[model samples]
Target: MSDKEIVEPLIPASGSQKIDSATKRGRIQMILLLLVCAAPVIASYFTFYVIKPAGGKANIGELVSPVQPFPSNVIEENLVGKWTLLVARPASECKVGDDACVTLLHVMRQLRTAMGKERTRVQLVWLVTDDSVIDPEIAKSYDKELAGFTFIRMPRDLAKKQRLMTWLNADNEQSAIHLLDPRGDRMMRFKTGEGHLDFKKMVKDLEKLLKWNPTGKVGD
Candidate 1:
């Protein structure tokens, strides 16, 4: 074999190696970028879930192992930049004197109020789960302008409503209050009942979240 032919075969092999190396480097850079964006959220969650504080008090709300994302088709705004506290109740169920429903609404309001100056970082979302018109009185009570609460009604399309219901009731606890992180992941849920809900612990859980994730936007 001539020297020219030997060198010609080696050139293609060298070029192929360079292309493979460049592709790998590109992949690595992309992965690192994603990790950098995810680190803050992962670290905060690790602290809350794995590394307990001195007293060893775990989160009162049940943490959703893998958080659920907001249903984009149903929610016009995916609530990307705010921590959302969401609850689902029919307008009829939330009538003025209904104690269970009333207490649930009251707790939702107080939870945001408890955030104090951090309250703006949090949003209260009420998902009205039925077609019945909300009482003017109840609607006025949680007026968006006055109370900073956003009330979204269930989609009239049965399939869309079912999808939303499935997301909201992932734990099969339909009445529980769900907490969605700034990136729009439903990360934790607080159970509410006649007397089972622990208001103080719920407040602490929320306070810790706002304290740890102050920016109200993931990877900030």
Candidate 2:
């Protein structure tokens, strides 16, 4: 055996092997590219269809979708530009010691106080079906329990004329408290008589809303 036979000549890599390696690399790169391109779309579809995050809102009250617009009088009364808790009650029931009115007043006060400093941005307002019929004792109670609370007169005639209750989805019963965002759109309804009004829950929800809308509170 000569040196030529002893030292075998170096063989060039087989074209098929090179081709297979290149094909594997190309396939890997293509899969990576596809994943990069489709990741967002797949995630979005899963989030929208399967997760449905928006449907899991934490608010205890019924969310008033398509927030109701405020009547002109409400706007004029300065209901806008501040988060409002609208308590609708017939004037006849607002008498002092009236259990419903008393409970409502206490809850509204608690709700406001629970906001801490955010309380400044909140206002508790009463919508009376007949202000003229309001008992003096109730007025005094308002001064006591709800010192800065606002009173809006929405007599039957005025409510019908301005479509206030219609817009607010309110009735003569004062059993529900309507929540309005700073934009004056009615957003939520917490019913009282049905053991549905959770003061702590309302406070937490309002705090979240206010936190999200700090510099110019707006809501849907």
Candidate 3:
């Protein structure tokens, strides 16, 4: 054989491998696209990183901060189009007598209605943290709340670690609705001092967080 032919005969033949190459190239393109799409979100947050909500209370759960997404912790999963939390705490120790249940309904209604377009995707999730068979009357109150929410019960130990509750002193606290973004992380606190969780000042900050995870797009 000629020197070139002899060398070629010893070497392995190469296949087209077009599909493999295309898949790698496509993956790179997808990654780049995600980065491009997220650029605006980064810029907005960075620009307003120091800016707070219009009023007071601008911190974004700095006290509780974010949980950094450990698998051991529980996250509010998206249900239907709504994202909700089955708070392992109760709304109040007060009996659900008179029009209290109805009033609670109104509060929940307002909260949901306030979300407007997001209403369809967010809800109140009242979770009883006990194995006791709830009586029919108490169950009725739960059902009433469910009308405005996605209510259920879970073991206190398991549900209490949902992260948000850790921020709120739930030792004998009330069940407060949590506001969650499309992603499953607990990015804000809704059940704060009086009325609702204080976010008027941090609304823009939250708006940024909702759009982008503080962690990098791929790793953060």
RMSD of each: 4.7, 13.6, 9.2
Residues 1-220, candidate 1: write the lDDT tens digits: 7766744344355788999999999999999999987764675587687666525786678888777888877767567788889889988888888888877878888888898888888888888988888878878988776666888888878888889888877778888898888778888889886666888888888887777666584321
| Candidates by TM-score, descending order | 1, 2, 3
Q: List the residue pairs that clash in candidate 2.
A: none
lDDT score, candidate 2: 0.67
lDDT of 3: 0.45
TM-scores, all models, native as reference: 0.86, 0.63, 0.46
How far off is model 2, as Cα RMSD? Answer: 13.6
In candidate 1, clashing pairs total 0
lDDT tens readout by residue for model 2, 99-149:
877788778878877877777778888877654577776667665235557
| Number of the predicted model whose TM-score against the real structure is largest | 1
- Ranked by lDDT from best down, the candidates are 1, 2, 3
- The 10-residue segment of model 1 with minimum total lDDT is 4-13
* 10 residues in a row with least lDDT, candidate 3: 63-72
Candidate 1 whole-model C-alpha lDDT, 0 to 1: 0.80
Top-scoring candidate (lDDT) = 1
State in Å the error of residue 145, model 3.
8.9
Better of 1 and 3 by TM-score: 1
